[model samples]
Target: MLQIPSWKRILILAVCLFGIVSAAPNLFYGRVEAHNDAIAAAEKAGFETEAQAAARAAWPDWLPSGLVNLGLDLRGGAHLLAEVQLADVYKARMDALWPELRKALADERATVGAVRRAPSDPGVLRVQIGEPAAMTRALEIAASLATPVVSLTGIGQNDLAISAEGDQIVVTLSEAEKLATDNRTMQQSLEIIRRRVDEVGTREPTIQRQGSDRILIQVPGIGSAEELKALIGTTAQLGFHPVIARGSATGTVPGIGQVIYPSVEEKGLNYTLDAVPVVTGEELTDARPDFDQNGRPAVSFRFNPAGARKFGDYTAANIGQLFAIVLDAEVISAPVIQSHIPGGSGIITGNFTVESSTNLAVLLRAGALPAKMTFLEERTIGPELGQDSIDAGSVAALVGMAAVVFFMIASYGLFGVFATVALGINMALIFGVLSAIGGTLTLPGIAGIVLTIGMAVDANVLVFERIREELRTARGPARAIELGYQKAMSAIVDANITTFITATILFLAGSGPVRGFAVTLTVGIITSVFTAIYVTRLMLVFWFERRRPKTITV
Candidate 1:
């Protein structure tokens, strides 16, 4: 009475076989991982060695090689929570706007009178006019500099909010613009951090934005949080500013639109420089570590065409003046321009060690962080602890699985054995899907698998109990089996669908380990449903056909 089409049966068998093959590589994770890494390294180096060749032979290339990626907690890593200083960007925007505002007001000297920058808080640009009656004209000129915010939520709103306070014009970023700027700054920082981490080649590192102003980073196999912090903490804000004056006193006050920076190679030496840079590192096309003419370590850089022209023009005019090379607000060198510099290439020579020079080159090539960040919390997980977790999780999985298999076999005899086989296939499918999707496996993910092993037979149990009920009313074994499956379908769907919904919510709303758990659970639900309904039934049908009994006991 119950029959499966030959095509459906073949399809189910093919899927099960595929799951087994796909998940087989995970059983030998270490060898497979080494082989993959060796291939990657050889390809990058553009050469092959005997060891690499041997590694390649360890596994056939034609077979599926993807393995589930281990999460930070399971792999041992450094974790950091950093808060981006969004206000610093706001202040920088205001400072950069100062020069343009002054130039604009100066152009309208007849109407705005003598305009000068006034002392104000960070992110606030205050301008005072010599004539109080000229305030209105100054505000108009400042308003002209504002542009419409580009974001949809900020439609019809200006980038800068300008106001007149007494005889001064106060300028600050508008609320809408601030939100957009903060989002951009966070995204930029996240990308730069990812590039910096990737340059070190430490496997899969998790770099993500947290709240409005925070970032979470986790790098597996990293020695410590301090090491990771050292890698990305440098803002690497490279700039060439015209030097105003040189001094040894730290207490010297810089004039408006000027900043004082200490020399990197010289103790007690400082230089005052213009706030605006002639050329920033944002225009850099390439940077590499190389030796200077003096044979000392230095970073060589090339700029884009636009930057090259600006550098060439500025150098040609100020041939004798000193220009300060600033990195992260500190002047590395203030070299006097000996001749016109064209082609946009230059060397930054400081008291740099070879390692420092290499790191500097890497940071320059990765681009600069949009703003500074302060670490709010830091953690480093040791490999020993991670191994312990893996060991415990493995033991728990084996124990839970053994208990489930034993319970199933004891409950329904041959039918339980059928359910147990399906459960095994269910797990294989879960792992196979995880590998295929490149999903991360965390500690909680392992727990989810263990739980799935116990829950996988629930559908089979429902079908078996329904068969017993159908036996009382149905005339034959085939008729009872058919009615059982038909009646059990609704309940199985309802239960699994509700559980799948919970997993979806966890994946969407949760982060880190919670998401990992959700992924494992969701995959488990899908595979369990297939194995219980199709795989277990296929085994039962085969057994029944072989015996050809008039009545069968489930």
Candidate 2:
């Protein structure tokens, strides 16, 4: 008999009802979005304003609030393709190594003679020894500083490649170390970019690596590419260096281990500082905008435990000396230490507006980008264009549904009505799953939904065709319907399983929009199978039990 048990029928109806309720929020997307944003802002600030309260009240708190996030193609914002300068990390590595190597050689000055740094390639450190015969001893000293590379593939390999060329000792990163550094640098860049974007509280921004040295950023709801660049482009490299001397821009050249940087506020004035910093922004634990004693906008920062100890000791030892506050390469201020600042907390005071101070705090709190990035391509999509895409996608989906519904009804008369109802439920289930999982919907995803609408009725067609075949025999209506479903089950499962496997492959192998299409297709397939195999069958069972007719049209 064509019958479903009482519990099975209830389960089917409950699932369809749950999907409709969960997807209802999308019908009033704008109001619900505002309500969500308001609640988020209030929670973050720990207090709600009048406007926030009003917005939160726009939607009921008891209803399902999850909404499917729209992608850049549907929401419209900034897109950027940036290339990371991996070579920059090489120079930084060399610079940091120079002080340690120079110290090691100086401890063995009698054997190596006098060691002086010589100019070399950007990523190479070269040292000139006064005695040519001591070259082998110099190489030994440099090699002692090499540590094992801290990567799985670079096991048993040292980080530094040290050799002798004439009277000069050459040191550069080893090949294995270079490979490890490139991967580490790219990973750090991606993490820092994600942090910077997330700090601004944007919804579902795509920050992902594209190739070996490139990143693709798509931030929806931002104003433009330039704004997005301004948010994440600044290196925000902050350091505290001991100032050696201050003079005009044309002053004498700095020593081997020192650098000269122009002051941020004072025109034509420069300060020479130690190359190594007492503490860098990487150790910073907190940073926020504040006002100075003179009511000028500034940034206040605190450091972690290790950095605090180093900073406290440095300030205690050099009480009256100038401490340079460097941002990027320029000295923000080189204030003389009035006392031993033991807490590792300090204020950065310079020429700054409130907005600039706040932005600096945000950058410092997010940490520095490991390497510089150069933007190769940028685009800013308008919201109007996104609305047009949504409108077109809506039209396509509606037309596809209408066509599918008409074909089913014209072919199978009243059974088609049950499949049409199941089709509507199928669409609802797709969006419901998307909302529940916080999935993003793109223009390509819309195409997937439209494609699913046409495919949703496929199982019904199979079953109805099978029933037509059985009706030609001498069997009664109930037995014919039961036989149709039983015979069609194998074909339905096989076809859907094959299509699902293809969707999974596309998802694993593709990127960006292709992945978006795959996500929707995958979700649609699952929902369509459920509605076709179960929901439509349950509806048919109810109709047959009520009518109980001996003769029925196929």
> Clashes in model 2: which pairs?
none
lDDT by residue for model 1 (323-430), tens: 999999899989999999999999999999999999999999999998888999999999898888889999999999999889888988988999988998998999
| Model 2 agreement with the true structure over 1-554: per-residue lDDT tens digits | 88788999899999999899989999999999999999999997689999999999999999999999999999999999999998889988888888888889899888888988898887899999888898888898888999999999999999999888999999999999999999999999999999999988898898899879999999998999999999989999999999988989585788877899999999999999998888999999999999999999999999999999999999999989999999999999999988988888989999999999989999999999988999999999999999999999999999999999999999999999999999999999999999999999999999999989988899889999999999999789999999999999999999889989999999999988998999999999999989998998898888888889989897
Worst 10 residues of 2 by lDDT: 249-258
lDDT of 2: 0.92
Q: Estimate each model's TM-score.
A: 0.89, 0.96
Worst ten-residue run, lDDT, model 1?
Answer: 545-554
Q: Where in model 2 is the C-alpha error above 4 Å?
A: 250-255, 291-297
Report backbone clashes per prediction.
Answer: 0, 0
Displacement of residue 250 (Cα, Å) in model 2 is 4.6
Clashes of 2: 0
Number of the top-ranking candidate, with lDDT as the measure? 2
> Highest TM-score among the candidates is held by which one?
2
